[model samples]
Target: MEPPAPGAGPDRPGPHDGDPGAGRIWLARAALLGGVLVPLVAAGLRGVLWVLLGVAGLALTGAGLWWTLAHTGAVRACGAALAVAAPLTVLGLYATHGMLGPAVASLALVLLAVAAAGRVLSPRSRAGGAAPAPATAPRHPWILMNPHSGGGKVGRFHLVERARAAGARVTVLTGRQDVTALARRAVAEGADLLAVAGGDGTQALVAEVAHENDLPFVVIPAGTRNHFALDLGLDREDPAAALEALTDGVERRVDLGFAGDRVFVNNASFGTYAAVVGNPGYRGAQLRTALHDLPELLTGERTPRLRMRSGHRRAQGLQAVLVSNNPYRYAVGPGRGHRGSLDSGLLGVLCVHVDNTVQAARTAGGRKGGLTRLTGTEVTVDADAATVPVGIDGEHVMLPVPVVCRIVPGALRVRVPRGRGAPRGSRPSADWHRVLHLARRSGPVWHHRPHTTGG
Candidate 1:
């Protein structure tokens, strides 16, 4: 309804203009320091018992995670129970000892700290290689809108009417024909731009076609999760806003990750998530299916395992492997956990392998633990089994073993509106050093301004 502003929403302001947001940066620093001290102060008050209880809970949680990801049957159930009970047990201990206030306060401070970290760490702008201004608008643009994707975001946003109103032809997908074929038909019919108002699965298909035809591809973000759109800094909440790119836009060359020859806008998932998502019930009964399947699939009789080879380094007995188009920075909630650049020109690989609780504990603090992350031009995933279940862009599929993944740098021409907001996860990974330095430079309390989350 309103004018287009990518990544902007009711809570997130649109087009920052000239604001550097210095005041909020200092507040974020204060929150982070307070987040740490509150817990320490609480522990100091509770003394040895508090320290022991926290360690015990973390250990229990670690053990539960180990078993949940690698055990089955009764053992698996107990592991799940331990995992669930660990945090609750700590809370209970706090409540029984009259330390409930401290516990809740510490937790709230920690949550605030994380949110502040996200706000501070997230990049205010794309680092470099800003998209070039487009020379001309498309003479004919065709968008395929999935009527059901993202729980009917296309219809809910009235994307059809909006896109058509923008002078672009719209086709609502009704499972009537192959989506890739339909796009090809549109391109062959002299459509100069290719766009999709659907999920990442559909985005991949249309994106590949656009790449092959040397046409600019626009993502409408009318899909569930829309990881690609989020990583690209598009407006997820307003799918219609992306249509602004059709008229006023810039062209940026972005890379696409490929498993074998299949293209993916996001990452190719294997092991735990892949196995669970491959189940048919995932669509109709997601939570139930995940709860039922995760434990068994993780450590069942014939648990699926993978071996990841990123360049020469190899990690074996991996419970899961995520091969992404580009590396993802520190992620928990908000601001981080997505790729910073689509044109990083490397495959981001994450390998997980924790056989027991000890390994899990070590992993919680040490780098040599079971988890491994690295980037390479090419990475290969192999399993002893002839085939592996893979979740490519969240679309379940069974692929032959030794699924090789690689990044084709700047392989696609992506069009986004010029005045887009900061893409999600663009400034992932907080630098504590930066925070400290910023605090010293922020001047005194008198000079400090009210905190603001700039658009």
Candidate 2:
């Protein structure tokens, strides 16, 4: 099969896709080797000892992270202190050794080399890359704009005027109105296309109506954090840019994640986060509210111990969980925290289970660490209580126990302008194994093929 389009596959196009010749691959491998050697040669055995100290500091930081979940305020404060002290302590030790500048510079070089190697050597995903269908202008397009969202992003961007000029009907959600009702009314009034300019939660409500009616849906980044729009590669800074999709657009089918009966365009967060968001002070000040609320939730009389199951795999006593429509692809750099593809037809599950400092230290970089990542068609999360709290795409709600999360493949048809472009590809995690494979292979390999998961 052909490599999937840039935005439709886990391994989207990176810099190497254009020209991945053997010479470049060999150069990348050499750079990675050189990077490792430079640190060893410069730091020497003594430097290695210092680096070990740094790693110990990382372990202390991990201990701090785990302590933040403690019920005692003093313990949480101490944990925060350890997290802050780790790097400062490392810098001080280097300064005392009089090799601070050289060591830091060498570390930076090592990082650059690793990034380059990862970009070139890592394999791209080849699943769910089907070409999006071509689309024409809708006769009656309707928009539901939330004035309060994103600090009045709709009014600030003049979206209503521009959309009206483009011959689309627009309705302003004045206050506490039902978005689902407004979306349905628009469809009943002959809206061939449905769109929303609000948070992901509001978008999900309208999207469900659009999906059921077989209409195209457009998203505007008018939320506090436009997670869905960012993944779609829409210009979050310029909310108006999304309107172009109405008049000049193409169609791409993407899946929606479900927590019980509610649909979410993004991931569903449970346990600690769900409780934090439910606090009355959360919307006013998130960090402060979470700090105030965490002690009780973490040390409550009846802590909510979660049990998660997917297929034959099972995990218990997780503190929190994030379940998404498709697995998110993360890089070591900037501007890429979105999913690799929304049509992967599987639920990406992340279970965080850290009972103590040791587990926290052991589970630092995810998988086998405290944070467990997996993918399956369905996942069930249950607690000791009859009902559980959930944060679905930033909206707080309570779901019945044994809450089932599932992926609805091709459940939403999205429209974007033909001029739409993807965000910069995320750099994959460093893979020494892939680098070695490149060195051993006889011929140049620059194509993508299918793999199950964990790529």
Candidate 3:
């Protein structure tokens, strides 16, 4: 079948798409724009009057301290004292000058501006143009749910009954069963649609079977962080709403990342992150373990020797490597974790090779210090060791040397609810260029004249 045009689909129209809520959305956008610009103008006026000197001093000091901490794995007592003292000194100075309130408000406005910018610039749903699936519900729909996932979401939400009500056979996955085998059996049993309500890892396994058998796949967001579901424009907060897809849904072809035989719905990570997740204690205390291991992973000489080759370029001694199924937008604001388009049929590769804490600090500061980011259809990584630790959609495993990662374009038919609209956090923030253009045109000093061709 031919692919649908971008933003042209049989899916339900969004609130901003000629719906009654379009007016309200426009009003909100206007408010957000005002909120972003008003404060910036006010701050600029203050800066012109030299009233922002104190704020500038405070900001610079904070940035310096943050840079210091990033460069040094361990903070010295003197450095810690300085970090505290610099902020206090700024506060005290502002308080003495009776400018504390204005300074605080300025800072708050800056934050609001950043948030508004994100909301305005975030990309709209690419799924808008996807073709509609069959209006009739699947006759033999099989849903494999993990009861333990998302703290027993299946039981809490009565997903089995809900699935049954939607004409689906529900199977609760326990520790004893294999998800891949279960999916295969469901296919053999003549299941028309394969669905899963679990984490991305489990969902990926079932999705692989569905893709291989040329069956439509439905995703129920019952995971703690349903990155795949979010990308599919499903309601992550409400798993029950996803059941609507089985009956009324749109079929979208999305790209999937593969590392050898294993498939991942989100991303396949290597180097530091993969090693950290491979630790036995990581699942229980993820943050603590990551924090404890990061210094060693970043600083120690015993770091794993990782080398990557994508196309004609090659990189080595990387601290971390993230191979996303689709390219993720990295900007200095919110809405950074989402993909612009999932069917782009390309892998997003980010390799980090920070030699020292200072370089790491600069890299974190967006200086591109020892960081290599590119897009390709395939990537091959070879580690010094015989086996390399890999993190596939948050699940850790040990894979053999020379791990090959590639993007499988349009390999999976993802079904999402017709009324789901755009997924949360998928919308792009306002375009600064457009905003500026409008601003310049609206100015009292600017005017335009119509031109005629020998009329």
Candidate 4:
């Protein structure tokens, strides 16, 4: 076939690449507005108050511009500007007036700028803390919407259209597209905020892309069970709400987990749960089946061999291993024990060692008496098979036995709703839940805590 026509490499498109320069003019204009002019105006005659206000105003304006440019899919220069502006601004202030207060004030202003940028740029906040000024100007927020997430609510909810209308400048990815690749491309193309509309696993995939570049991510819950989203206090039922939050919501920093080289925004589990979830037939199973089958997973008899190491301790034959960046344990009702926070910088490991149904029941009951046990951080797991399928944030991957997992402290920013339980202190929610259940089996409704960390 004539060597498949010269220069026709399968991966390479022949001489007909689409024009990327088409939007350069608009990008240039937007840069002039959001990046330079806004900061200049905001920085007018900087006194302390003016400086602070200018910092905030300029930061917000810059964030808006960054998002706008991102929506239009423009080139990145804003991020570079962000990287330098705060320090330069501080330096200039110090050089102009050498005094402790001025110097400190300048530094604070710089921090404020960083925080603002970080907030807008962060995916989710630990507790909606302000954004940090990026090490570089932030690339725009790249949003990937799953129209099918939340029952095909993408268009019905008017998120993409409204985001575009609201000057968000969105790019909608088709289901057939490689999500991970798309996220990487967006980052390379200058995205600081990588937003996704999907389930927990989808969020994890997008998070993988964001983490690779140290970019912040925004999670829009558009999937069933939305455990991660609900945990983050994102409104999964409404796409419009999520879109608004994506642009206007508060930004905060949270933690993530690193298992091998892969990054996870939530918990990673294996054993019976993994097998169940991995099975294509699992989703079709009835609730009765779930009740009947789930218990058997912890028995170790039904589940295959599993070996694990946690810091100094090593454990084997674990029926299930759940390593959560932030413990997801929560009380079933009010006045219950502490729930884990998303930003606690700790990993929660739950391993099942029970070999019988009675023992499994105690573990499931969250009582300290069962074969189900809880421990903290830095764990490794291995299997007899050279490659054991692993579940990360509910997504499965094949890896050699003895998978190592560790907490990557302060790696993500998550948004969590303020809860009412902790007017006093934060304790592990499982313990508290157990206490509350003992007091009254009926239990109170679980309340959201003010802190970002969960039990």
Full-model lDDT for every candidate: 0.75, 0.76, 0.70, 0.54
Please, what are the lDDT tens digits per residue for candidate 3 over residues 127-180? 334454544568999999999999889889999999998889989887869899
- Runs in model 4 lying further than 4 Å from the true structure: 1-139, 169-173, 284-302, 333-339, 361-372, 413-455
Please rank every candidate by TM-score, starting with the best. Answer: 2, 1, 3, 4
Model 3 TM: 0.74
In terms of lDDT, the best-performing candidate is 2
The number of the candidate with the highest TM-score is: 2
Per-residue alpha-carbon lDDT of model 2 for 138-180, expressed as tens digits? Answer: 9999999998999999989998999899889999998689888
| TM, every model | 0.78, 0.86, 0.74, 0.58
lDDT of 2: 0.76
- Candidate 1 per-residue C-alpha lDDT over 167-220 given as tens digits, one digit per residue, 9 for 90 to 100: 999988876579889999999999999999999999998999998898999999
Error at 397, model 2, angstroms: 0.8
Q: Which ten residues in a row have the lowest lDDT in candidate 1?
A: 446-455
CA displacement after TM-score superposition, residue 445 of candidate 2 (Å): 8.3
RMSD of 2: 5.3
Cα lDDT for residue 322, candidate 4: 76
Q: Model 4, 326-361: lDDT tens per residue? A: 655544355332224566566777765655433433
